[model samples]
Target chain A: MSRTKLDLWVGFFVVIGMGALLFLALKVGNLGGSNFTDTYVVMARFDNIGGLKVRAPVKSAGVVVGRVTNIGFDTSGYRAEVTFALDTRYQFPRDTIATILTSGLLGEQYLGLDPGGEAEMLKGGEVVQITQSAVVLEKLIGQFMFDKAAEAPAN
Target chain B: MNGLLNVVRLLGAMVTEAIWRTGFGARFFILLLRHSGQSLTRVHLTIRELYFSGVLSLLIIVVSGLFVGMVLAMQGYETLQRYGSGDALGVLVALSLTRELGPVVAGLLFASRAGLAVTAEIGLMKTTEQLDAMDMMAVNPIARVVAPRFWGGVISMPLLAALFSAMGVFGGWLIGVVLIGVDEGAFWSQMQAAVDFRFDIMNGVVKSVVFGAAVSLIAVFEGYDCTPTAEGLSRAITRTVVTSALAILALDFVLTSLMFRGQS
Candidate 1:
């Protein structure tokens, strides 16, 4: 075979190989999402995080704006300190409510943000004070059963 | 008693020979690395070898990947549809191909295709006294011939594996969304959501690189060390394929355990 032909074929092979890698990174994997945008770390302390794992999505009105960067126990406050990397484009008020919510009856949990009416925007490394813990299904069921039993005699 | 003693003696000799070859192979790899500069500097020699090992193997790799992906989608949809979660087919196909099937299957195919051929070529050179002629002429055959082929296989392997995986994802899309009427939006979205670039894709790349180095080294070593006879050449070729396949599987298991154990 001619030397030029061989070079052409090898060059084609390398290009397609790299193209495959690019496709995997962008289309098949999550590299093309909001990861490219500048993000600010926002901290929230929850009493319970209930299977809210690291890298879980953080959504605002069901739109994913960030991801959970870290989940650790707050030894001083007896709470779970969940750190989020939210996109810089979206700003929430200082009084924004951060709640741990699940997608379905049985699904992975995510952190939901409800922007508050306060004029002050939450800055990087700032903590959102108003936060709700994940709702434990067993605890919810137990409380419901207890309330129902208390009302049985009256009925 | 005589027969039993002969069996034990044979086992002992086999063990010693295996150890000897392993030590020799290790030395050969170190020498190859040291002499690899010549191949790198020349550039074209390595590129020529790449055409032989990588470009030639592309067809088999792509076809096998497609069929595997289609099969996985068909089987996954059958099970997933029972629970009405057929859309997860994309995640299933993508994850399996990128994480396991892509690197492992491609490595296996490469071993049979390129690895065996490399062994055969080098063994023939040895059998024909070409390496001896080079030695007489003060030319280092290891630098001139072996290093280029070794580097070629190593470079071509990861590229081939990546192409295999890309083809696999395409195949799954063809079968699931195009043929089976699964939701296109859900197929792509869920795949993008589930497959992490660093964890899944990067690890697959790492695995392929490791497998490539292993297959290339084993092929060259077997060729260089084979006895100069027709029977010896055939045995060396067989050993190359078997050793490469076993190494790929074992290394994959070890790598997977180390890379993925702590994550939840």
Candidate 2:
């Protein structure tokens, strides 16, 4: 084969290979949508964070506004301390409630923010006082069974 | 009692031979690295080998990847639909291809095709006394012949693996969304949301690079160290494929453990 021809083929191979990598990064993976312009960290404490993992979406009104960055156990409060980075464009008042909610019957858990009527806007490093824990199915079922037994005796 | 003693002697000799060959392979690798400057200086040589090794193997890599991805979608959906999360077929296919199958399968194929060719080519050159002629003329055959092929295999491997993964994801999309009536929005969104670029994709690239280095080194060393006979050349080629395959799988396990341990 001619030198130029071989070079052309090799060049084509390299280009296609690189194109495949680019496609995997942008299309197959989440490289495009993950870029946030500016962000601030907000901490919320939950009594329980069942199956809540790091990098889960933090959504408000069913739209993702941030990502859960860190999850740790607060040693003093005996609660799950969840930290998330919210886009600067979206802000909530000091009374916003952070609730742990599941997507579907069996889907990933996310943090949902419901803003309350408050004049003060929350800033970075401030902890949201009102938070809801992830509801455990076993606990809910146990409570339901206990209530049923108690009512049966009364009946 | 005599038979048992002979068996013990044979076992000891095999162990010693294995250790000696391993040491020789390591030294050959170091020597190849030292002489590798010429392979880069004359870029055309490496590019030529790249054309032979990488471009030639593209067809098998792409077709196999597509079939693998389609099969993964079929199998993944059979189980996922039972749980009513059939939309997750995209995630399952993408994760498996990018994490495990992409590098492993591509590496194995590259070993069988390009690795065997490299071993045979150099073995033939040796059997023909061409290497001896080069040495008599004060020319280093390792630099002129071996290093380019070595670098070519090393460079082509990761690129081929990446292409395989991309083709696989395309295949999964074709089956899941185009053919089987999966939700288009949910399929892509779930895949993108689940497959992290840094954690999954880069780790795969790392795995391919390691596999490439191992397979390339094994191929070149076997070629360089073969006994320079027809039978010796046949054994060298056989050893190249078998060793490369085993090395790829074993190194993959080790790399996966180190890279993804406790990640879940």
Each prediction's number of clashing residue pairs: 0, 0
Q: Judge the docking of candidate 2 as incorrect, acceptable, medium or high.
A: medium
Error of 1 at A128 (Å): 5.1
A-chain TM-score of every model? 0.91, 0.90
Where is model 2 chain A poorest over a 10-residue stretch in terms of lDDT?
Answer: A28-37
Local accuracy of candidate 2 as per-residue lDDT tens digits, B56-118: 999999999999999899889999999888998889999999999999999999999899999
**CA lDDT, candidate 1, residue B218:** 93
What is the fnat of model 1 with respect to the true interface contacts?
0.83
lDDT of each: 0.94, 0.92
Quote model 1's iRMS. 1.2
Candidate 1 CA-lDDT value: 0.94
